[model samples]
Target: MGVHGHAVGVDFGTSTSLVAARAGRLPVEVVPLGRTTRSFPSIAGFRGEQLLVGEDTDDLSGDAVIRSAKRAITQNLETLSVAGRRIPADEVITALLAEIGRRAEAVDQPLSMARDLRLGCPAMWDGAQRQRLLGLAEKAGFPIDETTLVDEPIAAGIAWVMNRSLFYGERLEGRLLVFDMGGGTLDIAVLDVLSDGPGTEPEISVLSALGAELAGDKLDQAIAGDLTSDLAAQGHSSSSARRPELFTALVLRAARDAKIALSQRAEHRIMLPSRQLGQLPMLTYTREKLEEAFRPQMDIAEALVWAALRASRLTVRDNRSAADLRVLTPEALRGDVDYVLLAGGMSRIPYVERRLGALFPGAQVFDNAGVQPDEAIVAGLADTISYRRLNLHRPGFDFIIEWEEGGQLRQEILYPAHTPFYSPQQVLSGQSDLGFARHDRDFPGPRSGSGRLRVRSTSGEYLGLAVDNQTMDGLVVRFGNRMDFKLYCDGRILIRDGSGRALHMRVDRWPVIRGRDSGRLQLRSAVDREPIVPTGWYMDKEYAPPIR
Candidate 1:
């Protein structure tokens, strides 16, 4: 399917935000949200009920200004105090999004005409987080639903493929790794790309996606902390010691600007004015100093890359060892990756490019000439909408619920892979209930005691579940009586007993199970199924009886 009309993509970063649009068959263009730049700060402030966002917040100061509102969302903060008024974080984010929409409209690129809209998010975000952002987007007047959400790293891969096809007249087909280092998080994804002939859009399937809260923001804080120490050494700690919050914000912003400058130069100057200490002497921040502050985070990023590779089963380590160790030796893995795509503002660091190149020796590292690190995600998102790309796919592995019965371990296939989980009808009704089953028929008779109930993948890797806001690999519940298990289309698992005691958790991560025919799983449409029966017993209708 081709784009029916205009399509818009929004990449709401922690420190900044960007919007891109594609009209009919035209190329994707980044919509300028600022006066002179294509992107603007992801910030909001209030001056006595007068709201300000993006570039408007540039001259604002004090607690009224909220910086990194996206980070606040990640930390699950419900409300933020702005100008003596407590405002919901979602509303703050909605204002920023709405501002972007207004700016796009002012430039004759209104989102109202967009037939498709895609919002990019962190790959590791839970269902609740995605839903939160979707709701915010909807409130901001961009037509959106669950389907509108796209993982940021996966979007980067889509951008690479689209760039290769549209400009270079080449189709990208092979294992692609996306290293997206943004302001607040570093997201790594391994994808399998395949093109079907000349004019057709490429099919991209995500093999594994992982993320860590290690990126530009942390790097900025590290640099700022080092600068603070230097200032204290020079007898200039009055203002910072008094108005620490305000002082910290100023330094972090300076550090962030210096970090960007150091990307293209050998050194950057950091200067700050203080009413308490008067004007302080300017300090030179060298590239070496920036790299020194970035080393620890870079180490974490390398480990995260290896972790994503292991999750995708692209490495040579045994499955058991790969699953057990958090980090693996890079020497143990072969250079099977075809291309390494870099995205996000932090990816502009020369050290980052060199490090990734050394890590993936045989793979082609995309340089800035071929890709714009900061614009890739938004561009890719717009391309996904323009080309009607089919990248979102069903789970490649089955979900297993395990528990002990009669002194023996028993397991049931809670949700099977490649099955119809969602449909347009379900979306219209705003219901995602996939299946439900009674515990008596789905599990073996339990002994008269509390037993451990675990949820795992088909490969026996325990999946994390958040029960009542607490994440756990397994849950302990009394299992002598009748219980109910309900599975939702959004990876939510709900378990309830006859006594009305209920426990629920959303499965955020699934173990990758490679197919026998190929190492990659084919992309499947998310809305290809019919409206599933809400009360249907999935275990009885699909799989055999529980295994002991």
Candidate 2:
């Protein structure tokens, strides 16, 4: 299997990246990037003209290595400095993607011939970030397009639902809350799943998604800071302080390892190398200490969950404003949620599960059995490619365009939720006269020469395109000027005036259907006769014990 005709799914994570592939109806396989492990570090190192990535960067010095390059996309940073060289953030990301491609091809020769490649990203990434990643993937030689991106939590949900149906013979429906806390971010999504008659695929709709940049890495820093303070109190010489950056890096790595170890045991020994920390004594980091360090971030994470639930519009016994809403004790949601699926590496912590279990007392909460939390996203991403091949995917949100007219809000539905993004008749095209003269007798527009337009989802979340007169007067002009509006399958909206001037805005979100559903067209009779047992790494893993 050269992956010549396979569907590849990539989870371009904050700390590590994973690649999975499915060929025809074959089981999805996680492509190994390291000698023994599947994970590839999301870091890059520069030495003169030579570039190193992932595990290869492990030996590089702090000044020469770029870690968490993914954060650059979120911060909108244009360049990163490495080894006294300034490099474009896009180039660094592209290099990482390119390396992944190379490794996948190494495992399966000519993986470059893969028919499709899909990437998983955070749900909260705006349009610009998504587009930037898409561009970088293309630069890396992946056959990616606008529809290649899938929200991480959505991917995790898909994996959980598919795993349940295929292995346990259980059909999960109703509302689901996906709590994904990875190395760099915490993303929470509330989705509604509806099943039709037996054997028919369930309809999945994302009610709301929210995220914050608070996760594993932040906790690691807190632990490191605590260790540094402890060392200072012991009268350890500050000689290592001269190379503060190097010393901090070593401590942080030790802290991260200790955190992971604490997940499995009550305590972990964190021993920094003498070369890195001088003659410091071995440190024993306890789970209690880790919990204390994580408390503040955990508090923020709990509040974020509440915010996401409220935004989902799910039924609650008492709906209160943010000011009055109880942060952690969201008893109102206990009866509303049917299941809580934990995902991301950070979710493996016992404390996280306990917290979620306590919050959703009436609901079943658990991680996908046999599936590693970090790999869930990639598995779901690969399964999505398989679903699309069978025409069993649908859009998750309704696309809408809005404007102001006669002091009232005017809007039009460009694409309704669950519609196929590639449907010929559904694709937005052509020009429509705004009839500015009819609405405003004082034609030729305002002296400022601008107007406002917004593109958003039915959930009331804006999708990044908000053109106001202050920015562009010629496009949203008055005086009955005709304009063309075209929405591409990739979430790109292009507007053109009669004068041929054009304005482009990307929807800042992916159009791929998140949950599960048949395409706009009816499913094939064969699909209805036999349920598709999605094959993936999850199939062989033992189920996790249920959390009641």
Candidate 3:
């Protein structure tokens, strides 16, 4: 059987967002709230039951809407409960996602094909947050079975790899790092590109991902604040205290504009309408002045780059160590990092390119006027969805494991995580004596006995992770059975069943188990009930009228 139809790619950004699609035809860009493919201000406002988003939300009033909610998604350690209803991070994301969906298919055909959507998620998302994103996508009209989470940096890296032929005649060699500088976050990912032959998709291996929310928007705000303070100190004050708010907003807008202009020119002029100022003149911003004003933010950017380099499997070093050689030798790791694709609007600044060039000398940087840095994430993701629909690559493997007594793990399947959705007669190998244990609440220690197979149903119906210790003399194992047991492990995603292929896996001593802490497991009389739905504010689901 073959698959027909195109998939959609969604770039749900912090300060801006976009959606792109190519359904069995050339890709057509989709813009939100206007004809522009990329929409901004990322702020949403409410005026007596009228919901306003994007540019219109910039209008400041007491009934002004939410701003920079994406930043709060990771921080803002407070729960907002209004009228006995709780609002959560996922709920906000879902609202944004639904808005994007509405815009993408707003014109003609129903976006039913977008059931197979690819979403760009941040690299800094932890396991719990990742799951929450998955749940949110499912709730926002995207089917869980069809949606695939693509890391923003990874998608950008893939875009670079795919377009490598256009830039270079030879296949790409050496490690390439994708430094994604966006409005709200900076993500750096190290990708090891494997030669997949001519016209074949490159097999990408992500060595590491490190990111921080300190991006262009933060820098702009800092610069704006500095300018506001300096102007106020110069005896410039509004008769009304509320005028400062309007003045500050204008400063921020001018700061961002000047930041972009300074990308090509050394100086730019910022016009103050003279509404708030008592006859103060307009402000002219120079590149040198802006850079000086945002030095602290630049320092943070440098720190984030160093942190990303340190997190990689390999690092640029003068000498190689024995352990390092076993993983990725310094000799193999050392090379010129190529094509630092500027994907986000933040990278539009000239200083960013100059700083990146100074940081990694000898690497060529290219920026095209047509490649919308703000919209590249969605474009690349949309292209990736198109590639997948073409069956460009196959899914990987998964490892299904079972817990036994004595802090031991047993392989329940030959392959996992990458397994096919449903496959029958798939046999696996496991051992009973393999020490796996359910901690006893009362006794609090390892028990010396064999344990039965454990399986649990995921939020996904008809999907399960089953591990049996009682099959085929504990050697031959078969999957696709219904058995309920509590299987605990260090990582959440231990299985990826891709097709009938058995993923490579091995049972070994558990990493967290120690000799002294061995007795911490105690069997309780009552079993905990399975969660029908996720708990906490992060999983709160709410619906608001679609953005008009």
Candidate 4:
């Protein structure tokens, strides 16, 4: 697919946010949202009645800035009044995204001209959470859709292939593990390179996917905890019991800066400007000390990586997909896996890279020059749009699609559990016959509608964006098999089964939502009893609706 025009991609991260775009024939370009930075801090606060985001936010004794809102949103922090109105990560994230959109529009070349927008998200977000993210993007001003909500690791994987596949395409005969460690989450995906044809490219089959709440922010907290204890040991007059908020706010920023510095330098000194201790001396932190503090977090990260691989039923040798299997070590393979692509801000840390390399020593690791950890997801998303359209989404479940083939009724699949969907242009040669469904342009009616608002409930039958009142794309929703409800995606309305080889097409269902933490859009079934509900908002579901 020859990318002909402009398309925007946004990576709304835990610590920061990025907006990128790909113009015709150009590389993915990061849209600078700050005066001197391409990455924008994902924090928002209120100054009186006005909302402020990014560079303008200040720590007004912890009341002014909302930090780690993404985690709160994902975990469904019920005491959202925990962070005030932006509580649970809703309003603050939307505000942050709106700010990003403003920045993109200000660029001289006019990125505003881009018609479609793609947003990257954690792979672990389930149906409700994904629905919530789409809702937030609408509140933030980006017109997104169900299909546009792509997995972050998959986007990073595409970006990896874009850079390395030109020469290494054929050599990537085996699978490549995508290990993404960002500010707030760790995501891993095992992709099997489709090499069944003579001229196959980097099209991949996502074997298994998994994510963890652990990430760089946790490392920063670990470091801060260590520093706080050491400072208290030095007989500094500290009472977190008295002012816990202030203490953490002060320590977290200082600790994060120290970590970033320690990445490029051997040592860093942190100043604890405190009144309790009456101006303490500077604390010197070496990379070794930082790594030591990160030990526990790294251990969890390593475990999650191997766990994800194990989920794929992949090991050093072939075996029955039936019998149990074990994860292989670098020594076990000796040399089989081709590459291990690392993305996210934490990957810049030498200790992280070292640990990852030790786990997969047989493969080459690329960090994309360390210039754009926050930008990779969005950049790759843009590349997917402008370069070749491919959706690396893993199907949620196996659907029994009933279609007619040789004048006889048959049952097959719209998509398999581990297979990926690709545009006709992006499909590799032999892989082309796989017959994966696409959601591009098959609808004949209105493309979208005023979104069906999901208020307090177990959850919707199927969580997908609505295209008009009649048609919708069916999201393979996760729910108990016995329950019943409607499923929708873009333009396709779904019942319990379908023809195996279906093509997806619907451009009008671009997702747009009027989200608000307080808006009550209650939906119930024609049947009795509600089955699904939000455990919590994922990606900060609803803090405030757009000012539409």
Best by TM-score: 1
Off by over 4 Å in 4: 1-3, 78-88, 108-113, 166-172, 194-201, 240-244, 274-277, 314-323, 327-336, 369-371, 384-393, 396-548
Which digits, one per residue and each the tens of the lDDT, describe model 2 over residues 1-548?
A: 11225677899988899898766544568889876788888889877778888888777776678878888886789998766678888888998989888988888823467666678888767655776887888788887654577788888887776666544557667888999999888988777676553344556666656677889889999998888887778775345465666676677778889889999999998777777556778888899999999989888888777766654542121333232432324676466689999999999898899888888888888787337888888887877332432211233444443455678765555445433222111111211111001112222233323354433433345443223213321225322344444443223345443333445543323334322231221111111222333233333346521111
Ranking by lDDT: 1, 2, 4, 3
Give residue 316's lDDT in candidate 2 (0 to 100).
27
Give the TM-score comparing model 3 with the true structure, all chains together: 0.65
C-alpha positional error of residue 362 in candidate 3 after TM-score superposition, expressed in Å = 2.6
Report the Cα RMSD per candidate: 12.1, 14.5, 14.3, 13.9
Local distance difference test, candidate 3: 0.50
* Residues forming the 10-long window of minimal summed lDDT in candidate 4: 449-458
Which sections of candidate 3 miss by over 4 Å?
A: 1-5, 23-33, 58-65, 76-93, 108-112, 166-170, 237-240, 243-247, 272-280, 314-336, 368-370, 384-548
Q: What is the per-residue lDDT of model 3 for residues 1-548, given as tens digits with 9 covering 90 to 100?
A: 12246656777777777666655434435455344535634566555556555656555442244555566554542332322234454555667666666665675423446555677877665434555666776777765542366668767766566556323434665567777888777877766566545444455555455667768778788778766776777766543445565555567767778888887899887776655544565677788987786667667666555444433422222132223333443233334355566667777777777777666665656443134666666656665322332211112222233445445654343222222211111101111111112212321212333322222112321122222221221212223221111212111112111111122222211121112322221122111332232222322335321111
Full-model lDDT for every candidate: 0.68, 0.65, 0.50, 0.58
Question: Can you tell me which runs of candidate 1 are displaced by over 4 Å?
Answer: 1-5, 62-64, 81-87, 238-242, 274-277, 314-328, 368-371, 384-548
Ten-residue segment with the worst summed lDDT in candidate 2?
427-436
> In angstroms, how far off is 303's CA in candidate 3?
3.6
Q: How many Å off is the CA of 329 in candidate 2?
A: 7.0
Each prediction's number of clashing residue pairs: 0, 4, 36, 25
Report the candidate with higher TM-score, 1 versus 2.
1
